[model samples]
Target: MTRWDAVRVRQGLVDSCCSAEQAGDQALRRGRPREARRHYERMLAEAIRLAEQFPDLSTRRDLTLAFNKYGAFWVGAHRLDQAAEAYAEGLAVATRLREENPDDIRLLRDLRFGEFTLGEIARQTGGPAGRRTAHDHCTTALALAEHLVGTDPHHTGDRRELGVVQERLGLLATERQELDEAAEWYARALSVRRELAAELPGDPRARRDLGVQYERLGDLALRRRDLEAARAHYDESLSLRRSLLGDDPRDLSTQRDLSVVCERLGDVALLTDGPEQARQWYDDSFAILDAAFGPKHPDTRTLRKKLRGHPVTPN
Candidate 1:
């Protein structure tokens, strides 16, 4: 092939990857995880091929992004193992890229994003050791985020990431039973998110980030068995989520998030009110999930189990 033809061919592959990733994102937003997976697979395959053939900066960057996005999708689908594997792959690629371009802000952020994601997955995997590893990884990411923010105080992306890192650090502290430290981190993150959300009220991503801070606080309160505090935080989260859902009811990802808040509220209700009140909350969650993923899906099935057995939630 002529050099011109080769360039065109590679460009075509890159275009295909871009389209596949967009399609995957759309599918995920609409609550069609299975459909999203197919598009993500296509995007990942093209990205890998491009990197293998070219091994150029652009190609490698695309490869890392593909893995990271796929990892995010797996996280939404509640597949921690798949999420971890994808994040690890992204980290491996991003580590080399960051070393080569230490001054490149985007590359540095990519590496930190990978580390941050892997840290969350480590916690989800569950164990004393896992929590310790998560704490270390997140602490490293927190320092990096702080450096990024310090370098460019006005950089919105850096600030946003800093908030997310703080949120995770708060969760890690909560795991270690350091409630005071956790509250401090959560407060810092909340302030950052409030700024971002106020700056971009129409941006769903910004609003969701803010909502997540409240949700994390709610989870912490529940851990303390403070039902009233948990309910208040969850109510705030649910309000933000509901507003987002109202903007786009067809968004499955948002629906899932709403369901989580609803279910958590149900946990609070079960403790405070009774089975009947909690049942109503559970039904609300079930309705959303059943509509989004059908009753046979694992999420719905787990909800059903909760309804039937009413197992005592440790939280």
Candidate 2:
């Protein structure tokens, strides 16, 4: 079958789920966690039912995608345990596929993605023990990603995966308080992401990844109390995120990112511009999040608490 035909077939296999997943994603971006979770659960159930009923390649791939999306949704909601479980489920499926088709690049890539995601969740919740587990998973993921890139240097997806692995290594190093090592890994990730963005200027995702690397660098600088460096990095990240938002105003995730950078800018303003300036920054951050996710969302609530000392202008 042609690639387009295969895509259509896959869509048909998962059509019952497409609307639920889309609704879930929209709710997630809008910051309604409960609603998003409900929709995602329905989507996952549908995916699982279809996969079990058919047990075909396309259906299995759809199932894997559902699990991965579920994991991502949980990660955004800060439900690390759920994220881990979902990722583990996806990993199991991917592993089975890889074992059956050792030479299939797509299956291998899926397996690598699963490993990397589980590693990330582990790093977030497993504490020191989790970090170790994350390190091992990331290391293996990096090796697989490298092999894939070497096999197909022109494949942008493989190259992007390599960059993602490097960024994870940077995060692991930061968790260990290995500043120099963290910087080294972050620099490598930035280099790769920048190259990809330059090559594909129209690729918003590539630009977003580049923004993420800058934000990571900004975070590391903040931890080190390097305010100037943090400010510069965050400014760059904000600019990119703003451009992305301008390009797609309906993207709630991008809107959330604007809130994040605004909060960071608030931090810097607090340190450099005193109470009034800081309040303005914080207010901007809170307003964006409040509009998207409502005032009761955990993130919006947390930002509200941060604004406690300041007089909040009514939205």
Best-fitting candidate, scored by TM-score: 2
Candidate 2 lDDT, 91-160, residue by residue in tens: 8888787777778888778888888988988887857999999999999899999999899988999999
Among the numbered candidates, top lDDT falls to 1
lDDT of each: 0.91, 0.88
Error of 1 at 154 (Å): 3.0
**TM-score for candidate 2, residues paired by index:** 0.73
TM-score of each: 0.72, 0.73
Candidate 2 C-alpha error for residue 246, in Å: 0.8
